[model samples]
Target: MNDTPGWASPGSAPSDGPDGKGQDSTGQNGDAQGAAPQDAVGQGPQWSKEQPPPAQWSAPSGSPGSSGSSGPGQTPPPPPPAPGQGWGGQAPGQGGWGQGPGGPGYGGWGAPPQGGGWGQGGWGGPPAAAKPGVIPLRPLGVGEILDGAVSTMRTYWRTVLGISLTVAVVTELLVVLLQGFFLNDSATTAALDDPDATPREVLNALGGLFIGTGVVLVVTLLGTIIATALLTTVTSRAVLGTSVTTGEAWRDARPQVLRLLGLTLLLPLIVAAVVFVGTVPGILVAVLGSSDGGIALAIIGGIAGFVVAIWLMIRFSLASPALMLEKQTIRKAMGRSSKLVRGSWWRVFGIQILATIITNIVSSIILIPFTFIAAAISGDGVGLLDSTGDSGWAFLIISGLGSVIGSTLTFPITAGVTVLLYIDQRIRREALDLELARAAGLQGYGTAPGATPGG
Candidate 1:
C-alpha cells in the first residue's frame, strides 16, 4: 500500500486509517472518524457541516427515541405546525415579525390573525353597512339614539341651529308683544286675583285671560307646525346622509305643512275629547249630586283618561317622520306609525320620555341660570312672571339670549332622537337597514349609492 500511494499525499486520501492529524479531501470530521470505524455498508459521510442544526425553539417531534427516523443514523423531516399558530420556525424570545412569539403554537406578538376576515361573521366585520350618516343602518341602542341625535345637530349645525333660533326668537318676541299689548296692567285685574272677587269681575278677567291664552296658543302651535315639518324633512335627509338647505327643506316640506298642522291640531283635540268624555260624567256627578262615589269616579276616570292619552301619543310617535319621509297621507302615516309601534310600545315610550327628559333637563339647566341672572341684572325690580315687570332692556336681552341658547340646543336633540327612533323601529321590523344602507352608499347594501349616517 505504501508503494502504490507514493504519488498522492496521505492527507487527500478518500479512505484512511485514523490519522492523528485532522486532514481530509472529503468533508468529514476528524473526531467522528477517529472515534468509530465504519464498515462498507454506508456512504463516505453521515453528517455534513453545510446542513443547518435542528431548530431548538421549534419543539421537537418524533417517537420516544426514534426522532421520526427509519434507522439509527437517519434524520426525519420536520413535523407540521400546530393549528391556530404561525408557520414560522423561529425560536423562543425572538421578536421578529411574521413569527409567533414563544414558538409555532402561540399567537402573541402580532402573529397572523387567526379569526375569519370581514363579512365572515357579524362582529368586527367590514364597515360596509356600518353607520354612515346620522345613525347606523341597524337596530339601535339607547346610547346610539342619543348619540345619533347629537350627531345630526353637529353635522348640520347651520341648518338645525338656524331653524331653532329663528323659531324660538320669533316665538319669544310674539309672547312679549302679546303680554305688553293685550295683558296691560289693568287695576281691575288685581280685583280678579282677589279670592273674594265678584262673579262679574272674575268672569271679565277670565275672559281677558282666555283671549291672551288663545293668542299665545295659536302662535305657538303655528310655529311648531312649521318648524317640525321643516325639521322633519331635514332629519329625513340627514338619515340618508344627505344635506339640505332651509329652502330645500321648506320646498320639500311645504306640501306637508298644512297636513302636519292638521294632524297636530287633531291630536290635541282628540286628547281633549278623550279627557272630556272620561271626566264629564264625574264632573256632572260632583256638581249635580255631591257624593264620595262621584269623587271616586272622577279620580278613576281622570287617571284612566291620562293613561289612554299617553298610549295614543306613543302609538303615533312615528307619524310625523313617516309622513315627511314617505310622503304618506295623514291617515296612512298614522296607520304606518301604528304598525311600526305595534310590538315596541314600551320601548318607544321609554325612549321618547327619556329624550324629552334629557332635552328639558338640559334646557332647564341653561334657562334657570339665565332667569336668575336676568332678575339680578334688573336690580330685583322685575320677576320673570310678574305682569308689572319693568322693561329692563339688559334683563330682557339676557333672558331672551338664554331662551335662544336653550332652544337651539334642545331642538336638534329632540328632533334627531325622534327621527332615529323611527328609523330604528323600521330597521327592526321591516329590514329598513338595507334600504338605509343603500341610500347611504354602502357597497354590499344592494344598489348602493350611499350609506347610513354615523356622524
Candidate 2:
C-alpha cells in the first residue's frame, strides 16, 4: 500500500511523514536507490511484485493504507517511487542523484518521467501554481496584468461602477455649475484677444483665466484621487476573488485618503520644482543679458527638466496604491513606490502610458457624440470652447453628462491597472503570490502564522 499524502502528487519526494521510505522486497527500509537488496534476515515479510490499485496508495505510516501490511510469510508490493526520484535516489536536480535524459532521476520504476508525463507536465516539476483570483499566482505577463484589471471591473461591476459613477457625477456637477456661473464669460477671452485693450483689461482677463483653470483642475484632481482610493480597495479584493461593497471600500480607504491626497499633491510639486530648477539658469541669463540667448537656453533647460519630471512621475506612479494598501504615510509610500519601481522603470512607465492611452481612447469615444449634441442644442458650437464663455446651461449640462459617463467607465480602468501593476511588481519581487494564495485559502498554501493578506 502507498503511504503518501493525497496533496503530495506522485513522484515528488515526500518531504514529511512515513520516514520518506518504503519497504523493498526484503521488507527492509533503505535508500531510494537501486542498490543491492538486503538478505531477508531480520526483515519482516517481503512485498509482492504485484502492486495494489492506486486507490490504496495513502500517505505515511499512520495514514489509512499503512494498515495493509502483509501477514506472516505473505508479501506486499512496495509503494511507487517518489516523483522526481529514481529507484533509490534523490529528487532530480540534487547532486549524486540518478541520471537520465530528463535531468536526474528521470527513470525510476513507477516514477513519472521527468519533463512530461503526469500532472502539470510530468511530476518532475512542482505542482502548478494556484490561482484563487483574476491572475495566476506567479509573475505576470503584460497582457495578464491588463486582463486582470479588466476582469476586476467586469466581475465587480456593482461596487466598482457605483463608486466610479458617484464620484464622476458629483465632480462633473460641480464643474458644470462652476462653468455655468463664473467661467463662461466672453469678456475674459475678448479682452485677452483685443490687442488695443489696456493693461488692466489684459490683467483681469489673465487673472480670470488662471482662476477658472485652477479651480477646474483642483476639482478634477480631487475627483480622481477619491476614485483611485475606492477602486484600489475594490481591485485588491478582486485579487482574492472576494467582492467588496462600495461602503466597505470607502470605509477601508477613507483613513488613507488624506495621505494619498498629500502624496498626489506632492508629486506634482516635485515635478514642477524640478522643471523650475531646470529653467532657472536661463531665467537669470535672460534677466541679466541677451533675451534671445536666454530664451534659447530656457527652452533647452525646460525640455531637460520636463524629461526628468516624466522620469520622476513614473518612478512615483505607484505611491497612491502603496499608501492606500499598506496604510503607509505619504513619505513611506513614495519610498515604497521608488523601491518597487527600481530596475523596472521602463516597464512601469510603459504600462502607465498604455493605460492612459486606453482610457483616453475610451473617454474620447464616449464624449465626442455628446459634444456634438451639446453644440447642436446650445446653437453655439464655438461656445463649447471655454474661450467664448457663451456655452449655455444646456451645453454645459449635456457635455457634463458625457463627462460623467466617460469618467465613470474610465476611472476603474486607470485605478485597476495601477493597483494591479503594483501587485504584479510585488509578486515578481517579493513572491506575494504565495501570500495571496494562502489568503485566498487555497488547499496546499495554508496560512502562515502572523501572515496578513493584501499588499
Candidate 3:
C-alpha cells in the first residue's frame, strides 16, 4: 500500500506538504543522474518500470545499546544487500550520495541505482529540484499561494500589467469624461443634502445619478470580464512555467468572453434577486399591517439575505477561473466550482477574504496620496474640502488616474490568487499536483514507457 501523506499524490516522492515545508530536507542525492527522475518532460514524479524501484527496507534486529552477538565495544554489521543482489555490491557512500538510508537496513533513497534509476535492480535517490514556475507542482500552503500569485505579476509584469492598465485607462478616461462633461454632479450633491430643493431639481439629480451609476456598472462589468478571462489564461500558463503575452492571452480567452460576461452578469443578479426576495415579505407586511413590524421584518430579512449572499459568493467564487481554464459551459463551470468548494467552504472563504482585504489595503495606501493631489489641483470653483461636483476636469482626471494606476497594480494579484486558489483545491482533492508537474515539465510527473504506479 502507498504511504505518502494526504496532501501529496499517491506514489509521489517526498516533497513539500500543505504547510509549504519539504517532507525531507536532509539533502539526499537525487536519482542516479544527480537529478530527480522525470516521468515526463514537464511534470512531477510518477512510478513506472522505467523509474527506479522503491527503496529497500528491513526491521531493526538488535535491542537498544546491545550489539547482536558482538561485544559492546564492537560496531554492528552492515545490513544485507537488496533482494537478489550479490553480496559484492558497492558499500554505502562508494557510488556517492545516499544518506545511507533513513533508518538502519533501509537502503532505497541513498543506494546507487544499478540502471541510473531505471535499471532492473536500482532504486530512486534524492528527488530533483522543482522546476521554476508560478508555483511548484505540489500541495500549496497559504504562503505558497500568495507567492505564486505575486510571482506571476513579477515574472510577466509586461503582459499582466499591460492588460490591467489598458482596461483601467480606458475605464478611467471614460469615467472622467462622463463625470466632467455629461453628468451634473453639483445638482446631485445639492439635491442630496438640501431638503428644500425643488422637485424638478431633485428629479434631475436622480436621473443623472441613475445614468452615472448605470454607466459605471456597465464599464466595471466589461473590465472585470476582460481582466478575469485574460489573467486566468496568463496565470495558467505561468503555472506551466510558460510566459504569456497580452495578445496571446487575449486570443486564447476570446472564445470565452461572452460566456464569462454571462456568468459575471448572472452572479450579481442572483445576489440581488436573493436580497430582493428577502425584502418581499417585509414589503407585504408593511402593506397589510403595522409599519413598525415591517421595519423589523425588513431589517431581519436584510440580515438573512446578507448571510446567504456571502455563502453563495464564497461557494461560487472559483467559477470564473474554472470557466476560463476548463473551457466548460457556464452551468458546468458553476458546478465544478461548487464541487471543489463542497467540503472546504470555510478554508476557501477565509483565503478569499484574506486576499481581498490585503489587496484593498494596498490599494488604499496607493490611492490616498493621489486623492490629496486631486483635491489640490481642482480649478472649477470648488474648494479642496468641498464636493467635486463643481470641480473641473482637472480633479476628475487626476483622481481617475489614481484609480487607474491603483487598479493596474492590484488587478493581477486579485486575479492570480483566485486562479491559484482553484488549483490548490484541486491538488488537495484530485491529485492535480501530478498534472501540474507534468505541465511544468517536471521529469517524474506522468506516465512513461513502463508500469504506472496507478496500475
Candidate 4:
C-alpha cells in the first residue's frame, strides 16, 4: 500500500466470498471424492448404514422453505426476505440510522466478509492518524490549524509567552520613549489642532508626526521580525511534541535571523514597487497635460497593481517559516512558499486574512480600554480621535503598557498561525506528516525501519 492511509491492495481488501467458479470447483471436488455412503462403507459400522426417514430430512411443513419444490429428503431453501428487510431481520424502513434500502440497518452488522473485515480492529476503517503534539500528523483543516496554534500557546506557555512578552515589552518601551522625546511637543500638537493653521504649519506638524511614526515603525518591525523567528522554532518543535526553552529557540533561530529579516523587508518593498510602478504612469500623464485621463488611467493601474500585490503577498506568506525551519535562502524560501501555495492561493489567503482579523480584533479589544484609561489618567478625557492633542508622559506610558499587553497576547497567535500554516501546506503537498512522525520517534510510520520520509 502507499504511505497514505485508507488505500489497500486488491488482494488485501475484504471480499464477499469465494467466486462462482471456486464454489463450483469445491462442489465438483466433493462429488468426485464420493458422498458419505462411500466413506461409511469404507469405515465399516462407524457410520449409519441406513439413512433417516425422508420426512425428517425435509424442511418442516409450515416453514417458509417448505413451499418450494425439492427432491425427496432434500431441504428447500428459505424464501427471500421482504423489501427493506436485510440480514438483521429488521424491516428495511424500520432500521435506525445508516439503514439503507434493502441493506443492513443501523448497528446491524452481518457476518464478517470472506477475506477479513468486520472482525478486525476499528470497525474495518483505516487506522487513525497519529497525533504527536498540538496537531495530528496529517493534512489540517482551517479550524484545526487555528486550534493547533492556540493549543501550542496553551501547552507551551512558558516558551511562547516568554518570547512574545520580551519582544512586546522592548518594542513598546521604545515606542513610548521615542514618542515622549520627539512627538510630545506642544507647538506641533497645537498647530495640528488649529483649523486656521497654514499649510506650512500643518506640514511641519505632519513631518514631526511622520518621523515619530517612522521610528516606531522601525522598532516595531524589528521586534516583529525577532518574535516571528523565535516563535517559528517553538511552533515547529511543538509539532513534534518537543519542548524548547527560550534560549534554545534563540539558538535555533539566530542563524537564520538575517535571512528572515531580509525576507520580511523584501516582500513589502516588492509590493510597494509594484504599486509605485502602477501609479507612476498615471502621475506622469497627469503632469504632462491630460489630467483627467491621467487620473483615470492611474486609478485603473493602481487597482490592478494592488490586486497583484495582494496575490504576491499571500503567495509568499509562508516564506518566513520556510526560511527559519528549512534554513533556506531568501529566494529559495520564496520559491518554496510559492510552490506550496500553488493551487491553494485562495485557501491560503483566506486563512491568513482570517488570522489577521482575529488577532487585530483581540488586540483592539485589549487596547481600547487602555486608550481610554490613558486619556482619563492624563487629563485628556478621551481625545483619542484628536491626534493634535499632545499626550503626556502618563498617557504615553499607560498606552504603551496596553500595547505591550496586547502584543504579548497576540504575537504568539499570529506567529503560531503562520508557522502552522506552513506546516499544513507542506503536509498537504509534500507529505510532511511522515517526516514529522519520524522526527517525533513514532513507531510504525514511514516506509521501513530507519527509512526517511519522502516528499
Query: TM-score: which candidate is best?
Result: 4
TM-score of each: 0.70, 0.73, 0.71, 0.74
Global Cα lDDT for candidate 2: 0.75
Q: Lowest-lDDT window of 10 residues in candidate 1?
A: 5-14
Model 2 is weakest, by summed lDDT over 10 consecutive residues, at 95-104
lDDT by residue (1-455, candidate 3, tens digit) is 33232122222332223552211223231122123223233353233444322222222434232222134433233333332222223343344323222232223433333332332333443233254587866567788888888999999999889999999898878777777777746756678678898898888878878888788878877987888899999999998889988888999999999999999999998899888888888888988988899988988998899789889989999999998999998999999999999998998998898899988998898889887887776643454434445766667767887899889988898999999999988877887767766666667553432322211
Residues 164-185 of candidate 2 have per-residue lDDT tens digits of: 9999999999999899888988
Q: Whole-model Cα lDDT per candidate?
A: 0.67, 0.75, 0.70, 0.75
Sequence-dependent TM-score of model 3: 0.71
Which stretches in model 4 have alpha-carbon errors above 4 Å? Answer: 1-125, 195-199, 380-389, 446-455
Model 1 C-alpha RMSD to native: 15.9
For candidate 1, the per-residue lDDT at 39 reads 37
Instruction: Give me the overall lDDT of model 3.
Output: 0.70
Candidate 1 lDDT for residue 394: 48
Q: Ten-residue segment with the worst summed lDDT in candidate 3?
A: 22-31
Candidate 2: RMSD over Cα atoms?
11.1
Q: Residue 51 of model 4: what lDDT?
A: 55
- Candidate 3 regions exceeding 4 Å error are 1-129, 198-204, 379-389, 446-455
Better of 1 and 4 by lDDT: 4
